[model samples]
Target: MKKQILTTPDGESYPILTGTGLLETCGQEIAALTAPCRAMIVSDSNVAPLYLEKVVNSLKLAGFEVHTHVVSPGENSKSIAVFGALLESFAEAHLTRTDIAVALGGGVIGDLTGFAAGCYLRGIRFVQIPTTLLSAVDASVGGKTAINLQHGKNLAGMFHQPAAVYCDINTLKSLTPHELADGAAEAIKTGILGDPELFAIYETGDPENDAEEIISRAVAYKSKIVTEDPQEHGVRKLLNLGHTAAHAIELLSNFAISHGHAVAIGTAIVTRAAVKRGIMKNDEGTRIINTLKRNHLPTDSAFTAKELSKIATLDKKAAAKDITVIIPETIGRCRMEKIPISALEGLFADGLGEQV
Candidate 1:
């Protein structure tokens, strides 16, 4: 197994382990980080059926009293109500500060379980076992944990770092093509932001043959950035490259659009706007849209600029009267653009094109 240790600016550190069959050793990893005790394995209906028993057995083998709680799958489960319910489960399971909470599913499971761990008895240890590619590369490594509110996605959350992260590439084999493509959007974003070579992997590398390296590299890039700006007070904001408009599209669609697809569209829109303003070369814009298209990700949204603009105002990235966005200044580089709220409609309108 290959390991990457993520250290935050404040000197906090955790290990992210990636390789085939890493999940079976999760209990030993967690035991080494903290004492052997009760662990609440929080997962969703979708994931629990597949891997929960194996994880529970691993923890039990390591002398941990394991308890499992499974929620219904999907974004809706990442709610305050579910979070509250999980907290009750923790209390019922008698989990203490020494006992850890293990997130055994995808991003939704990680976020909700992490938040509960953060709030329960003030705070408790937690570990991440991200099953989906999206969570493996992006959500699981960073300490950013949250549940959506009626207002916006991840409107409420905490910077609760996990004790360790287990990203078993073997788990990715079960992912559908759409699920795999969902993660490609984030990988593409990572490449565009800092690693042109990584970007080329999308264009040239075979995902089935190169999945491990791609996930490791993407996690490494994100780990470096998160370590530098854990709370997103500075460079960390750059990580939200296409998220500003992406979140808006998700909300406007009532979440019919998944986060990754919305981000694909958002990246396309930002590049289009950048190209129009001469901040990005037309070829760079074309490359991004083409890369997303090649991955089967959507680069256009049906939502109008006016509708998106209204929702964009509610995005967490938006400040008093303007929303700060990360725009690609060139391939492998980006700059922040804090656009006035009133002008957002025009920006989206200008960026909108038939790339579907």
Candidate 2:
């Protein structure tokens, strides 16, 4: 397995290993996290069927008592109702804190399960086996777990770190073109946050063909930031490059647009906005736009400027006096500029690709 040890914000180190056919190793891998006891895996409907049995078989073969709970897949399933059902499943089986919660799906499943584990018994252990590329590269490693609320995506959540995370690249073979595009947008965002050379790699590399190397780089990039600041206090803030506007688009669409695609559009907007703000160069912004388009993600969407502005006001990155904005100076370097709400109008206009 390809391995990297990441130290999250609270100074905790966890392993994120990537490779083909690594799902079978979940037993020996997670056995080191804790004792080989009862591990309750929370998964989604679609993905669980494809690989859940294999994971359970591996654990059971390795002498672990494994319990599995499968819920309907998609962001729509990330709700309080699902959490209640998951907890109910755990309670019915008489699981305890001594046991573990293993999340085995995409971002939705990982976040939902991780949040449940965070609250269960005042914080038990969790091992993330992220199936989707988006989860593998970003969602799984960060420890930012949350289910969506009526108001927004990831608005309801907690800072719950998992015991460890496993990224099985083989599972990604099932992705459709749209799904793969979502993951590519995130990889591009990582570049927008902190690596021009890495960003350049995507410029020439074909997402249709270079899935393995691209996923690895994205995972490695996220690990570097998450290891330093697990919490979004400083360096972690850079990771939010497209997230600010992306979350708005997700909410405005009622989540019709996939998270990664919204993020790709969000990235394009911010890159354009920064250029208009005179901080980011024109060439760099063009690179970001072309990248998004090349990946088959949206470069622009039709959310009114008024609605987006209001959503931005409620973002986690926004506070009483200022809001933190992630702007790329080049490819690998993104810095946070805390600016007043009043100063945002011009940039917003520019971000919409509307010239002053």
Candidate 3:
């Protein structure tokens, strides 16, 4: 297993392990961290049948009192109702602050479970066992845990770091091509923010063959950023590179479009506008769009500029009358630009290649 350590500014730290067959030894790893206390494995309907038993058995073998809570899989599960149900499950399980909650699925499972773990008993420890590529490279590392509100996505959440993260690349083999592509969007976004070599991997390398390396690099990059600004008060905002417009697209689609696809569209929009405005070179913009397309990700959305700006202004990143957007100056560099809410529509127009 390839391992990376993420240390926060406050000195709290966790290990992120990525490799094949890590799931089988998950219990042992958790045991090493704590005294084999009670562990609640929170999964989704889709993943429970596939890997829940393995994790449960592993935790049991490691002397942990294991319990399981499975929920329906989807973005819909990331709601207040589901979060309340999960907290109730924690209470019912009698999980103490010392005990850990294990998230055993994709980003939704990780986010919901992490948020629940953070809220239960004033906060208990949690472990992330990400099953999808997107969660492995993105959600599993960041301490940001949130549930979507009726108003927008991730409007309700907190910074609750996990005790450990086990990303078994083997689980990714069970994913469909579309699901795999879903993750590529985040990986590409990471490359855009920083790491030119990682960006090149998507441009010319075989992602499937380089899964371990890709996860390792992406985790390392995010780990560095999170460590620098654990609370997202500073440089950490760079991580929101494509997420501003992406969230708007998701809300507009009523979540018919997946997060990664929305990110692909959002990244393309931002890069297109950056190029047109001379913030980024035309060649770099073309490379980004082409890379997303190469991975079967979308570069455009059906939502009009006016429609996107309306929803985007309501984003959590909005402060007073300004919203901070991460604009790419080049392939491996990005900067935060705070634009007035009124200008957001024109920015979207520029990105959409429409006259503003």
Candidate 4:
């Protein structure tokens, strides 16, 4: 397994392990970090039947009293009701501060389980066992855990770091091509924000053949940023590169559009706008759009610029009058720009190549 340690400035740290078959050893890996106490393995309906038993057996062997809680699979599960149900499961399982919660599915499972673990008993440790490529490269590393609110996605959440993260690449083999593309969007976003080498892989190489390297590099880049600005007070905001418009797209679609696909559209839109405003070169913008398209990610949305901008104004990133948008100056470099809410529509118009 390829391993990297993310150590925050406050001295909090966790290990992110990426490789094939890591799931089978997940319990021992987590055990090395925290004692093998009661573990509530939270998964989704889709993943439970496939790998839950393997994890449960491993944890049991490691001396952890294992319990399982499975929810329906999809973005809809990242709701207040699901979160409440998870917390109740924690309570029913008698999990304490010392016990750990294990998230054994995709990003939704990670976010839902991590948030519930953070809230139950005031706060408790959680371990991330990401089964999908998106969660492996993104959600599994960052301490940010949240549930979608009626108002928007991830409006209610906290930064509760996991004790450990086990990314078993083997699990990705079970994903559909579209699901893999969903993850490619985030990896592409990561490459554009930082890591030109990673960006090149997407442009000219096959990601399926380099999954371990991709996950490790993405995790390392994010770890460096998160370690520097754990609370997102500064550099960490760069991670939201395409998320502003992406969240708006998600909310507009009632999450019919998955997060990664929305981000693919959002990144394309932002890059298009940057090119229009001369903030980025036309060649770079074209490269980004082409790469997303090549990866089977959508670069255009069904929503209009006006609709997206209006919903984006209500985003959590918005302040009283302005919202911070991450604009790419070039691949491997991005800057956060705070624009007034009134100008958001114009920005979207530029991105859509419509008359502003």
The per-model lDDT (C-alpha) reads 0.88, 0.81, 0.93, 0.91
**Model 4: clashing residue pairs?**
none
Against the hidden reference, what TM-scores do the models get?
A: 0.97, 0.95, 0.99, 0.98
List, residue by residue over 287-327, the lDDT tens digit for candidate 1.
98898998889998898877888898878878998878788
Which whole-number lDDT from 0 to 100 does residue 259 have in model 3? 93
**Candidate 3: pairs in clash:** none
Candidate numbers sorted by lDDT from highest down? 3, 4, 1, 2
Question: What tens-digit string does per-residue lDDT give for candidate 4 at 193-245?
Answer: 99999999899998989999999989999999999999999899899888888
Tens-digit per-residue lDDT, 59-177, candidate 3: 99999999999999999999999999999989999999899999999999999999999999989999999999999989988899999999999999999999999999999999998
Highest-scoring model, lDDT: 3
lDDT (Cα) of model 3: 0.93
Weakest 10 consecutive residues, lDDT, candidate 3?
Answer: 347-356
Model 4, position 156: C-alpha lDDT score: 93
* lDDT (Cα, tens digit) per residue for candidate 2, span 1-356: 67778776566878778777767989988887777888898888798779999899888877788889999988988899998888788788777878899999999999999998998888888989988878877888878999877766777889888888888788988988898888888888987776665577678665656556766778788888777777777888888887878888888888889999989988888888888878888887788888788778898869855667678777666788688778777777777888887555555667896543
Better of 2 and 4 by TM-score: 4
Q: Better model by TM-score, 1 or 3? A: 3
Q: Order the candidates by TM-score, highest first — what do you get?
A: 3, 4, 1, 2
Q: Supply candidate 3's per-residue lDDT for 103.
A: 98
Residue 349 deviation, candidate 2, in Å?
Answer: 1.2
